[model samples]
Target: MITAPITLSQALDRVARERPQAQAFVAPGERHDWRAMREQSQRIARALHAAGVRHGDHVGVLLGNSGVWVQIFYACAMLGAVTVPVNTRFKTEELEFCLKQSNVKVLLTADIFLGIDFLELLTQVEPALASAGGLPGERLPCLRQVVVLGERCPAGAQAWDAFLAAGDAVDDAQLQACIEAVAPDDVLLIQYTSGTTSFPKGVMLTHANMLTNAWAVAQRIGVSADDRYFSIRPYFHVAGTTLSILVSLMTGCCLLTLPKFDVADALQMLDAERCTLTSGNDTIFLMLMGHPDFDRSRIHLRGGWAAAGPQVMQKIRDVMGVPGMCNAYGQSEASPNITLSSFDDPFSLRAAGWALPHPGMQVRIVDPGTGSPVPVGEAGEIQARGWSVMKGYYNMPEATARALGADGWLSTGDLGEMDADGRMRMVGRLKDMFRVGGENVAPAEVEEVLHAHPAVRMAQVVGVPDARLGEVPAAFVLLKDGQDSTAAELTAWCKSRCANYKVPRYVAVVDSFENIGMTGSSKVQKNKLRAHAVALFGLEQPA
Candidate 1:
């Protein structure tokens, strides 16, 4: 009964036809209706084609959450050109790797956005872009052109106005031909996963994969055209693009986006837009509640969409006065949506980290050691096979093979168990587990106990190398404002709550986890945390 659009191009066209005058998206100082957006996308696609971007070509979009960013994404889809979302936080070396790996042909970028000048970075990455006769780099042989999304473009890059005008040379009929040529199974996006332990892998996802996932998520969250969806996360992240942005598009909701996440800025947008639903994690919600400007009277917040524990979700709903909560849990590889939670569900039926799999998705739990399904109510590695699953990792065949089993199931790596009611509860990732002596320890179990403490705001625990025990848990606690608690006191508190092996051997109360590295999705890079812990403790780790 639920028939979503087959491709991004088709979806945009359908929406534009049905609701041409409806508000599509709004940002800090810009707004676009469906008709305008569709026309803009068509013009951009024609310009890209004139610039020699053909089908299956990779077009890198290097910027924040702006109208131009969304325009370029749909433009690429119209031309059947793959959109390679380049992370703004990536350094020169990481940028080099992404460009070389993706073999991007065209780059649609901005001169400056989010306090970062992408044009400056592009010049540094490819110096020829600043000089006459921009030549391809030895490393990036496939890249042909760089389109800057502002005035005063660099030597090798085309200006935003000029690029738009270039489309005038091509007729609308020619652009329509390109749009009609695209297929649903064609790869539309290649999102690089946030690699915590190893190098990031580009996950190839088709329009079908994204559309289906967004449809299920939108339906479960009860999204509608009447709702104003708040998008706080970055456009580069899966949560931002597929979950929040595309979900809004699928449901015909007005997407209110911000370039960056600031407590004040978010509050202002929510108040101005009267946002009915907000999309973010626990960190964003906690900051919103704690901000000095936080006044419930000004903002009409009806609900929030986020992934967190039951206590936090309840706090987000009942305590924070943002009821009609929404929940989602999945990595980028599953077209990023595997499970969902509805706000209408009663608290008695809702357990922490439990989200019912979508009817279109097939979820299974199997023992890590054996390829057999575990008994119901028992924990095991979570696997998924369904419409939402990704095609595979782009240009990484062996990595793809390792993730997708021969049995047609994608090994999700996370450990979880299924309840009698058929809901899945993720316990912890297998890689996140550490052995304290001969006993195994899951950081989540310890972190859960720490979260229960009155003073502790949030916690991230990791395994640090120990000479005697081989590995012991190290805790990083972020306490609430005006709350006081010592590392010794927290350790004692955790000791009283959890098992000996699960208890953290040491605790470090930190000011900013951002001083350590973080993934684009706001997840703590535990590998970096472990290395930092080792250096802090003056301890050696296994190479």
Candidate 2:
């Protein structure tokens, strides 16, 4: 096996040298081979250097999933500059917060995507973009340059063509010096957390932290140069940048993606490209397999990884025909994966919702309250210590101190149990777990029972306030198309399968959580669901 690259730029160089003609990226209307990818990234790196971005500087990328996004990331890596991927779904306030908090110097963005005018949004945040040289504003003092990657470039921003042309004068020797100076320990990505409960914190991940984790994930899933990977993960999140993009690059596979996820479009691409590997959470898999256009025979899926429960894993293998699909668990701070089931593992073991920690990564479940190790088979907060842990949260010392301990263990804030066989089974997030009177209740256990029902397609459980019991499970469910089920019936279904306290006291059938509770990374935001449930049921809000 090839040794892992110390830096992302080195990874790109190695892949280009080894497989110059191999396909590296494919999106709608665009494609790049390994050699072309590296060259384009180097050109962009020169342009960025010409624009006054230097080592240790933060460059914010606000674009959709496209080749430009990948090029910008590699360009930043080549210069030892950190890439801060702003969520495309960000509103005015969110965009402003990310820019100011990260101290971004150069901003690369699309003019408009999905009908959201980012240039207009930036103007709203600073209001200076309306005039000449709009940047270097009072609101965003560090921001000096704005490069727009579309037809309409505002007065303060340079067009994509102009930005690339600026690099023509930069000599190869100067660019090579910058690339040579980049080390494994330099900060590569500042991935902001999803901010489910609070404001997002920028997780500072070094080149070594991300590249090493991607190499490990690729090995576990048995990825190779012959495979084509279809991933629906948004590029702004760590799941997209590290697991999907980096994994595909390291293995010399084509990374296929869509700017915006459409069920029909995704299905068509899978069949057209004959994609071999794919990755997603339960919701994405449900949408794909549950779609009216789903036909497993045409799509040549071999294997991939899923951050899902047993129900979803089983369906992906049996119904979706991805037998090599493995169960996975992690958060953004651990470069996104702490445990993953190997591709060659038996279906029974893979479907059991247990994931083995990657080699060199140490995982220990400890009591959330006491920090004491829990016995095997007992559930507790999962803590991981290894090279994969992020350096720290950028500019948030208190948050960093809370997340990373002095001894090197990074507290994941997730709960799980380790079996005697050393495989870990995720119970639920500690914040997501609620107490019913006195007994602890995991929402996943109840959701699993709900998933077993024939009519249910997807479900999310949250605790709502109760005067007598202190808290009780309230479930939001989406039913299968052409099927019918009521809230009372589903609650009764769960009552029969789950313990008394584990059963949801109420169930609300919803058509979708896309607008209400889903995050950019496709995770169900339970805090939002919990708030919605409290308001929907007229229950007293938790203090």
Total clashing residue pairs per candidate?
0, 0
C-alpha lDDT of all candidate models, in order: 0.82, 0.90
Q: Compute each candidate's TM-score over C-alphas.
A: 0.96, 0.98
Name the candidate that leads on TM-score: 2
**Model 1 stretches with alpha carbons more than 4 Å out:** none
Model 2 per-residue lDDT tens digits across residues 1-543: 235449898889989999999899999999899999999999999999999888999999999999989999999999999999999888898889999999999999999999999999998887766678577889899999889998888787788899899998898999999999999999999998898887899999999888889999999999999999999899999999999999987788999999988989999999998899999888899889778899989769988889888887888878888879988889999999999999998888788778788888899999999999999999899999988899999999999999999999999989999999899878788888899999899898888888878788888999999999999999999888888999889988987888999989988999899867678888789999998999899999656
Residue 3 CA error for candidate 2 (Å)? 5.1
lDDT of 2: 0.90
